[model samples]
Target chain A: MRDFDLLQPQHLSDALDALAQNDSAIRPLAGGTDMLVDIRAQRAKPDVLVSLQNISELRGITRENGTLKIGAATTIAEFLKHPELTKHDALRYAAYVFANPMIRNSATIGGNIGSASPAGDMLPPLLALDAHIELVSKNEARVMPLSDFFLGPRKTAKRANELITSIQLPVISYQSPVSSLQSPVSSAFYKLGLRQADAISLISVAVWIQRDGEKIRDVRIALGAVAPRPMRAIRAEEILRGEIFNEMNLKESARIASEECSPIDDLRASANYRRRMIAVYVRRMLEQAWSKTQ
Target chain B: MQKKTILFSLNGEPREWSVYPNELLLNVLREQEFLTGTKYGCGIGECGACTVHINGEPILSCLTLAIACEGKEILTIEGLAREGKLDPVQIAFLDQTAFQCGFCTPDMILMTRALLNEIPNPTEEQVRDYLRGNLCRCTGYASIMRAALDASVLNAHRSVQSNEE
Candidate 1:
């Protein structure tokens, strides 16, 4: 940890002003779980750290106009504790397995996204939820889809002067009547880590499906650690969306998802292994989500 | 970088310390406050060796900055005992011989206390899941698991005794 100036802003506007300093080295410090480690390893050397911990405006979960708005500073522990979030199983499951209890107690949703790691546990679920990120700077504020936010590993579309304010997720009801199966949205998340807890994902998958009668109304398949960034399998999604819900279509969708991701051989797993697991997990998640819809 | 004084309550004592922006809470506690019970096993957040309770939640101190501790209530392993008596978790660890090397004991005990605080009597799976971050190379986790369960029972007994009295 090299010496750096610390700016503790009690207000979001103050924090934004601090970041608005034109200096690219001025970085917003959320949960230090990732940033501090990077700093200790000398991977990230920001000249100034604008602490967002004190900003009350960027810390909570709220629902407005059918959107689940999660403040960027909301910790993983907070995410799990929120009663309303339990319905979002894919996001909740991801939060449950996000490192160990201690790390989760401190790690923030925004920090996870801010790190923009390919293997970030929260990425796949957020992508599957079709989350929109709200970024605020001194001059202006903007919202963008989570898919377009990530440019590469540790890289994002967020400007140097901006701070991520909140993540907005569309609320979909998963508990519609089983008889009619009217607009019941179901989702599932799966992560193949080295160990049960405190392990980074070797490959992760999240599936979100909305059923309309006997057909798939809308569907999203997001894969992590199998690409340059957490990405949606659009080609695979196309195969299942608006199509009749069946085993054959699910298998084809899974196969296409495996083909769409360009995973590289890493220390944890080989590219071949990741590609195969993507197909397997995608299929499993699809099956799990479909069953939930019933 | 300019050093700033932060005021916070540590182990039931309110103290002020001037620290650099880059100073981690772990280093500040050990060096500035002389509360070395919070061990520094891994500088990263992976290992829970530097675990401490801020506002009653266990978090890795290694990854937390000292300045962030301002106006927050911090509880370290040294704060667990009261009136010269060890905490229930500490007593259970001693009875169970939960540690062989004792390097990870402080954090393990802290985590168990925090766990029991949340779930009065947690199941074996829950205990393992909750304390997974606090890695112990010794004892193979069996004794630690026993200690966590025993601590829950001890806590129950203590509460009962207090209720009766």
Candidate 2:
């Protein structure tokens, strides 16, 4: 760690003001987990570090009108404990399996989103749930859908002067009595890694299904770590909507899902292996999602 | 970089200090307070050696900025014992032979304490899930799990005896 100017803003306004002042060289740090790792690797060298830890407003979990708002500075550890998120069983399970306890406690939703890595553990769940993000600057604030947030791997629509305030997620009602085949939503997200606990996903998928009896409704599937960004398999999703929910439908969906991805094989796995895993995960996750409704 | 002075309670006593802008809580503990009990085996967050209780939650000190300590209470491994008496988790670790090289003991003890705090009577699998972050290099995890279970049993026994009286 080189000698750097640390700015600990006591309030949200102050933090944004500081960012405005040091717009060129300042990087907002909610938790040093990602920033420090990047700094040590010499990948990032910000002359001024904008520390958001002291900004109390940035740490909380709240819900209003069936919308869940998670503060950007809130740690993943904190996110895992939120009763609202836990109620969303699939998202909570993904959060639990993300990384070690230490990383969870020290890493932030903002940082994870900031990294914009295709392998970001929380993004798929948020994307599948149709989450919205709020970004702030010294003089302005804007909210955008998660789909519009990412530009590429490690890139986003955010300007240098801006900072993420919180992420808001629309809550889905799962308590209503509905037939498994006719439920409004049947969805699941799966990540395949080398082992289980902490390894990065070689491939992953997020599938949300709408059902009308044995006939499928609008279906959305998102895959991650296979492209520059986590991508919605729109073609595959198109292939499934209004289709019959059966083994044949699942097989067709899986094939479309595999071919829809633009995965490149690195040392972690080969492109061919990723395509196969994508198909396997698509079927497995979709079945599990349907089973939950049943 | 600019600097700030923070005052917070450490263990049971209040302490005030100033830290450099880039100083992490782990470095401050190791260098300033001379609390080597909190090991810094991995600068990265993967290892649990730098684990500490930040306001009762286990957070990696290495990844936490020292400036964040402005008003929060911190409990390191040294704070576990009170009045020179070993905490039950600490005693259980030794009784169940939970360490080989003794390097990961502090982190293991603290994590076990945190786990028991949340789930007073944790099952084997629950214990393992929480301990996934705390890796013991000497491969002393079997006894560590045994020790956590033993601590739970000891608490049950103590409660039963007290109830009988």
The TM-score leader among the candidates is 1
Model 2 spans > 4 angstroms off: A64-66, A172-183, B157-165
Q: Which stretches of candidate 1 lie over 4 Å from their true place?
A: A173-183
Listed per candidate, the RMSD to the true structure in angstroms reads 1.7, 2.5
Docking class of 1: high
Model 2 Cα lDDT, one tens digit per residue, B6-30: 8998887899989877888999999
lDDT of 1 at B10: 92
What is chain B's TM-score across the candidates, in the order shown?
A: 0.96, 0.93
Candidate 2 lDDT at A101 equals 77
Candidate 2 lDDT by residue in tens digits, A241-281: 88888898898889988998889979999999999999998
Query: Candidate 2 at residue A113, lDDT?
Result: 90
**Clash statistics: count for each candidate:** 0, 2
